[model samples]
Target: MKKRLWVIYGMLTLATATWGSAFIAGKFAVQSFEPATVAFLRFFGAAILLFPLMWVMEKDRKKPTLKDHGLFVLLGLTGIALYNICFFLATKHAPVIKSSLFIASNPVLIVLLSGLFLKEKITRNSIIGMAIALTGVVFIITEGHILTLFQYGFEPIDFVLLGAVVSWAIYSVVGKVVLKKFSSVESTTYAVAYGTLFLLPFALAETSWLDVQEASLTTWAAIAHMSIFVTVVSFVMYYNGIKEVGAAKASIFINVMPVSAVIMATIFLGETFTLAHGIGAGFVLTGVYAGTNPNLFKRKLKGNIVKNKTA
Candidate 1:
């Protein structure tokens, strides 16, 4: 049992690490292909793999209803298409490390949205954590000069990254509904197919077949990494982790993503880590921990009280 648990943990860790490396891959991919095209290519490749895998794993699952199809469309539009478009556009404009940090604050947004739309109970910890995480995001956006945010305003890339966060949060919230009808693998496969279909016209409008052919090997390699490692492999592993350990525990592994992205950005892309990055990352990670695991502090407090009573 211990060994099996360790294997699940390892899969989650590796999954998040690959997701971190996606920022680097996305940065390279956007340099050659437009954002829509880049997103399309990534999912296009992923859909090819996911369709077959979903068939093999979930073939016996019940089919989707019309309402479920609507939900799948929503998931595709929000999570896969819009999110990736904003993601690649942000990577094109901002430093990958900064972009990763902004994305790291996503859980805060997810918590807030879940409370609002899903009617989930909003705990005090969630409110506090959201504030802290938003503050950290602002600090990073302004490069530690929070005052300048009022004086100047947000950069275009900031909006782009925020859009990515918002879209993904919506996807996650809606996914809670979709998960009732379909397995994670099945839903994801359907969403990817729809997203790729949605992205097709925009990708075609952005570039021709010749441009795709002319893209450099590095660009192709990046797309392939995102498709194979980040999308297919990491997502499957993450869903598996959720299945094994539950969502709250599985989500803790996401903290590894930004750290890994920062490190990989430094090593591979030659991006420098600033003082602002360090402080913002600390705040973001802390807030994420607090928000996602609202019961953790209570558990610790309860344990301490029991111990004191025994003494």
Candidate 2:
């Protein structure tokens, strides 16, 4: 049991590293490509790579039922296509930190949504952890700006990030249902491929493909990394981790992203990493750890079991 637990944590660390470097790659992407174009290219690249893998994973399963097929199509559209669209749009419009904070909201959301759809019980510990994490998120972004609360104006791009968060939350939660019908790899592959199909017109409409020839070698390298490492490997690892570790625990790794982003940005983009950021990140991590720990899950289950006995 301890060995399996360590493997899950290792997956979390690796997922964070992949996603963290993506911030640096994205910083490069926007230099030569529009956010839309970058997103379109990444999805297209992932679709091409993942489809064959999907076939291999699905070769043994019988034909999918009508309901399962429908779910797959929905997964493609919501989880794959729309998530990337909103994320890229958000990134283009807002600071990466702000965009990432909104994306980080997904962990708590998984807890909430799990309660709603999966009948998971929410116990005191879960509530406490959720509160801690949400508060930490506020702290990270506001940087003790509690006093200036009323003066804050909403950024349009942040909404895009919010949309991304909601979309991904739906995707992760819905995967539970789809997993009954398909292997993790199969489901991920199909959803991503079909999702790429959802965004095909946008890529085709990108008049800037003509400009692809004029980009610097560095831009090409960054785009390649985004396509392969961030898009393909990251998504595969996430689904596998969710299967091995459970969605509730897997989502905590999302909080670890900003750390990697900071390091990569400092080294590659010359972005500053301040003490305030570190303090805020500490809060975020604390919240994530509390929220995802199996101890919290066990406590919640115990509470529910006791409530049933009392009833």
Candidate 3:
């Protein structure tokens, strides 16, 4: 049981890392491909890759119902198609860092959605950890000047970013319930396939998609990375993590994204690591640890009390 939990945590960590890197690769891809085209091709590629694996894994599992298929379609719509549309559109309109900050509301939204829709219990530790983790993210993004958030106020694009937050929350919470009926591979594979179909019209309609054929090799490589690692590998692992741990607990791990992104930038892009990065990373890691292991702080406090008595 302990080993399985560690494996799940490792999977979630890998998923978060890939997703974090997607920000960099996606920025590169969109320089050539249209937003819809990028999303379509990415998920279309993912479906192709995941389908065979899903078929093999699900061979012995129960067959899906018509209703199950319907739910998978809905999952594709909200989680993949709609979420990417809003995400691409939002970042197009807003500054990327500001857009990321707005989208970071997803973890909190997921916790609330899980509580309301899934009847998941919200612990005090989770709430406190969520707040701390968010504070760290804001600190990192704002570069220790968090007041910038208030100065900017809300922009129109903020709503679109919020749509992404809500869309992802719905995906995580609703997908959890769906996982009860289908294996993670089945659920993610069908969702990606249908999401590709949903993205087809939008991709076709974009005149910018013509540029895709003329894209440089680097751009094509970025798209491939997004498709294979970010979409196929990361999302499957994310879904499996959600299945192993409840959505609310798993969702908090999303906070690792900005930290990973910054670290990746330092390693690959020659970006300098700042003091705010250290503090923010500390808070984010500590908060996630507390939130996911709710009893951790309590156990430590008890241990200290025992030590004091012995002293």
Candidate 4:
């Protein structure tokens, strides 16, 4: 049981890394495609990949009901279609680091929504962890001087990223309920399909896809990465991890994302990392670890005692 849980933790960590890197990819892709068009192509590709795999894997499962389909459409609309549109648009106006940090706020929103909608309990440690993690994010956003946030005020893109955060929180909370009724693959596959369908008209109205032919190879590769790895693989791993653990615990892992996003942006997008980013990441990671493992301090103290006795 412990080993299985560790594996889930490892996979969830990987999923967060991919999700973090996606901000960079989306930043690149939006240069070539409209926000809605990018959302459409991404899920359209994801659906194509997921459908056949789901059919092969779920041969013994019962078919979905009409109500199930409706629920999936809702998931597609809010989680995939709407979330991606907001995300891509935000990328156009904000830097990847700032946008990802704002999106990282979703963990707190998820915990709250899960408590309210899913009847999950909110522990004191959870609140403390959330507050600490959010503090770290604010540190990064403000570059160590939080007063700057109040003085400079928020950019328009900040609110757009906030919209994406709300959409994703809804996705995660509602997804927890849907997972009880469907396999992770089934839910993700159908949701992607519905999301793709939802984006079609908007994409058609907004952008000429002829731009796709003109896109550089780098852009296409980024889109493919977003579709396959970020959307399909990472999402499956994330949902599976949520099933194994719970939403609150799983959401904490997302604190790792802003760190990963900053690193990726530095390496690939030529962004600079400051001391504030390092300090904020440290606090965020510590808070997440403590929140998820309420007994972490006790266990560490116990380990120290054992080591001293051996010495």
- Write the number of the candidate with greater lDDT, choosing between 1 and 4: 4
Best by TM-score: 3
Tell me the tens digit of each residue's lDDT in model 4 across 170-276.
88887888899788888899888988998999888977657867887888888899889998999889988878777877888888777788789889988899999
- What's the CA RMSD of model 2 in angstroms? 5.0
* Candidate 4 positional error at 131, Å: 2.3
Query: What's the lDDT of the predicted structure labeled candidate 4?
Result: 0.82
Model 3 C-alpha lDDT per residue in residues 1-311, reported as the tens digit of each score: 87888789889988987898887788788878888888988898888889888877778877778988888888998899999999999878887668878777788999999999899889988888888888888877887777777777677787888888888889898899999988888889988988899999998888464586688887888888988899888898999999998898888889989988888888877888899988998888888877877677799899999999999
Residues 44-115, candidate 2: write the lDDT tens digits: 777787777777756786577788778888888888888888987776677644675677678788868877
lDDT of all predictions: 0.77, 0.73, 0.86, 0.82
Error of model 1, residue 301, in angstroms: 3.1
Taking all chains together, each candidate's TM-score versus the true structure is 0.78, 0.83, 0.94, 0.88
Model 4 scores a TM of 0.88
lDDT of 1 by residue, 1-311 (tens): 76897788789878987898987888788778888888899999999999889889885888788989999999899989888888877766876456755676776676666667767666776666556656665655566876653453467788889999888877777776676667878878888889999899989999987887789999999999999999888877876665565443454566667666776888998988889878876776676566555576799999999999999
RMSD of each: 4.0, 5.0, 1.9, 3.5
Ranking by lDDT: 3, 4, 1, 2
Off by over 4 Å in 3: 207-210, 301-311
Q: Could you tell me the lDDT of residue 116 within candidate 3?
A: 93
